[model samples]
Target: MNSALGSRQAAAAVVLLFSYNGLVIGAYAASIPSLTARFGLAPWQLSTLFVCMGLAAIASMQVSGRLSDRIGARRVSLAMIPILVAAILTIGLAPSLPMLFVAGILLGLGNGGIDVAMNAIGVQVEQHRPKPIMSFFHGMWSVGNLAGASMLVLLAPLFAPDPQPAVATTTSVAAVLGVVAFVVAWRITPETAVVTHTDSSGTRTPIPASAYLLGLMAIGFGLGEGTANDWSGLHVTQIAGVDPTTGALGYTCVVGFMVVIRLLGDQLVARFGRRAVTVFGGACSGVGYLVTALGSGLPVLLVGWSLVGLGIGMIAPQVYAVAGHTAGGRGLAVVVTFGYATFLISPALIGSLVATLGIQKTMFVPALLLFGLVFAARIMPGREDDVAPSAEAEASWTEPA
Candidate 1:
């Protein structure tokens, strides 16, 4: 193991931190409507805000990756998580538009920093584990997402009528949880040796081809997820001729199955192997999206989305694990950046395509992307390749990023 804690203990802490990040993201998502109403944000403004957050997160990932490689992931995480917590609180309480924008940037930076640093830590811990555990860690992220959204849903009703009060209350609760998680994360950080590199010839190493290939896989998964986040509900609504509230249940099915698949992803990967599992997941998603785009009934839509969730859920953890193995923090950063970019661009890309091709046809885009995963998944590591590579292994990396 990497830090002061044993592998098992470190895995627990990593799970907690992953959940914490997910909670923040879920709370932020759940509060979006309220935030929109409170600020009277125009659609363009909302888009701009997301763009800013995404750009900042990208920058944060790059910086955090290099820093983690240089110093240590535990140290980087200690600094980043607190910033995320503070940013969350600031966002919840921002009094002006300018302040909200500033808070958004910090929120992105903090969240991104935590993502890179903690993932590095997770990779460190995974290196020493007896069996595959990355999926479980990532699964807890889904659990946190469910918990965060549920918190707002259950609590918001108590403060109903004004959206602001409900959002403020939820954010406050999330912040408290964030504080608790930050401490736990530190105490349980894994104790494996950190990966550090210095070129005696004064040359920087280029990222390997395998890492970039995995990044492309990340993009495929990212777009599939982003589509579900924004369009699944709307798509089902139009198809089933139902209200938004009823249509939302379709996407709920997606998320529910997503959480389930991720929770079980480890065993699946272990039994079927990573490459097999990924390719299977890709096929499932591709067929599921096709069913969704062509289906006319609510029941069918639900099944389609369930498949979509199940398939997409299997991807991220595997890719993250593979990327980490490929090049440690730098590779993880690359994959994370590629994956997260979908969140920012997928909506706009789909929306524009919807204008020309219609929503049903546009749904096929992600299906196509998901299908790409079938072949792209060849880059995933085999079960026997779980451990971090040695110096000799590092020297053999010649693939271009």
Candidate 2:
């Protein structure tokens, strides 16, 4: 065993930080309507505004991954804290859509930076542990979302007097949470950076093929996540005839269930191999979307979301773990950061799909994609093989991104 706290502590730190990030995102989502009303923007216009955040996140992931590898996760994480706090504050103080867009970009960049840095750290920590801990760490992100959403919902009354006032209040609270999380990250992360080294050539090495595969896998997983983020409410409203408040319940239930399952995922993955877990998880997710598409009423809708949560719980972490093991575990921070960037595209794609197809029917697309994931899981390499080149290596990977 690795001593007191060990890898688990590192994992917890990453998860907690991620949860704080989630809270900011949740508050932003909850406040979107207010933003639209305040600016008198159409749904499409609001979406366009939000796209800057996603794009910035994706770009930052790619840039930050390499930067973290060159510097260290500790520095990158510490530096990102102020950016996150600043971005949140900007959102609270924005006077125009353009200013909000700038804030969104900053927020996305900060979010991407934190995400990649944390995953890199989590990947490092998981390496020494007895269990597969990545899934659980990633799952904690869901827990953060739950906390964030709950906070927004609870604070709804604080802004009930006016849309702008409510949004400002929520944004202010989120900014404070971001600051607190930054302080926690700064305190826990060592000041002197821990650099991962390779034995050959006595020089730091770059991430290898598997790192890119993790990124591709992220693309698939992101698609699934995006589906939930963008469409769950649509299903509830259109199919279940629920009010927006009740429709929001669909996302809440799915995210809540996902968080719980992910929190316990390390134990589950330790008990069962990643391959088996992913296969079954993909099946469950497919079923969940199928249920959402065809099943009637709230009970079915909630079940669909729960199943989706359970299914996706382990997938993201598995990808992160694979990124860590590649290239003798060198450049892991970069791998995770870049791979995550690719995955962030899913939500926008889901939005486009929903626009093209009716929302309820579009929900089925995720199920179909998950069915593909079942096959993808089959092709995924085991933990050891993912790192070492072997005669048994079957999974194809792209050159380092």
Candidate 3:
């Protein structure tokens, strides 16, 4: 009874942590217009900021992943939460472009560290559960995105005249949420079971080739997602002729569909299997992106955006889940790093294209990228019944001191 109770509590903690992380990201996305205005940043300049953040985040993910392997994900997560909160505050208060750049780096570091640790912990939770629930955790992330975006939309009128107050208020809210997330994280179990393999000579075997294949798929999906996250609002406002608040609604639509689809992803994966889901999802996203690029009106464009959300919603969580099941923290790090590298680069690529071709035509870039997932879907983890326990899966859970 105690074990079951403990499991539920731990699962809840991880979910909350994921939600908080998503909230921070969503708020940042919602604040982009204000940030651009305040800093007088061009599209390329905004992409440059994303590049800085992405580089820092990549470094942090590598270090955090290695450290989590040695000390456990829970500890690393706990240690980084404070840093994350501080960075959020710093970003909100930054008065100049250079200061904002520095804050972006700090935010990226905090976000990357916590992201790896929590995902590692989430993998541990999935291992103990009866059903595949990783998608649901990510679904909660989409929910947080909705909540954060909605908050900004509501607060938009109040802060329209001043960008500083808007940023400060939103980030302050994130900091408070960060505190709550920290408490929840503290309640989760501290130790996660590590997965490893040994060969005939007793030497540890390399991570399975499938993990790398999944990483490639992740990169493709990340491109789609990163483009939507960084550019969706601008596309809607500038191209579709919507107000700034309504422009944010375009991203809200994307996340809204993502939340609904991801919440149901586990059941869909269980019923149809990963290959079918990945292929079909990719096709849907491709079609959706084409619609967004060619659609004449705001309503049509929003529908296309929503379809895109549904299509790619399951890709990242499933990839992370597969990596976690196969190689534990180390595997997750490698795959996530590969995936995030593409995500980070997406803004720069799209920004350059937007400069030349305009935002509407730039949608083709991610549309074409989505199709790559169809060929790569076959490499995803097979059905649960087909998977066998590895030497690392057999390792006993070591409780934290």
Query: Which candidate number has the best TM-score?
Result: 1
Candidates' TM-scores? Answer: 0.94, 0.83, 0.85
Q: How would you encode candidate 1's per-residue C-alpha lDDT over 1-401 as one tens digit per residue?
A: 33443346677778888889899888888888888889999999988898999999999999988777766677888788878787778778889888888889988999899898888777767766666777888889888877877888888779878777777778888889888887777676654345544355746677777788888998999999989988999998898999999999878988888888888888887787778888988999888999998998999998999999999888888888877776778888898999888778888898999889988888899999999999888656665665455443332222111
Worst 10 residues of 3 by lDDT: 385-394
Compute the lDDT of residue 139 as modeled in candidate 1: 87
- Rate residue 38 of model 2 by lDDT: 77
lDDT of each: 0.81, 0.68, 0.77
Q: lDDT at 246 for candidate 1?
A: 92
* Comparison by TM-score, 1 against 2, better one: 1
Residue 111's lDDT in candidate 3: 84
Error of 1 at 323 (Å): 0.3
**55-111 per-residue lDDT for model 2 (tens digits):** 787677776666555565556776777787788777867999888888888888888
What's the ranking of the predictions by lDDT, best on top? 1, 3, 2
Evaluation by lDDT, superior candidate among 2 and 3: 3
Q: Candidate 3, TM-score vs. the true structure?
A: 0.85
Candidate 3 regions with alpha-carbon error over 4 angstroms? 1-6, 36-48, 95-99, 195-202, 231-250, 293-300, 354-364, 385-401
Sum up the clashes in candidate 2.
Answer: 1
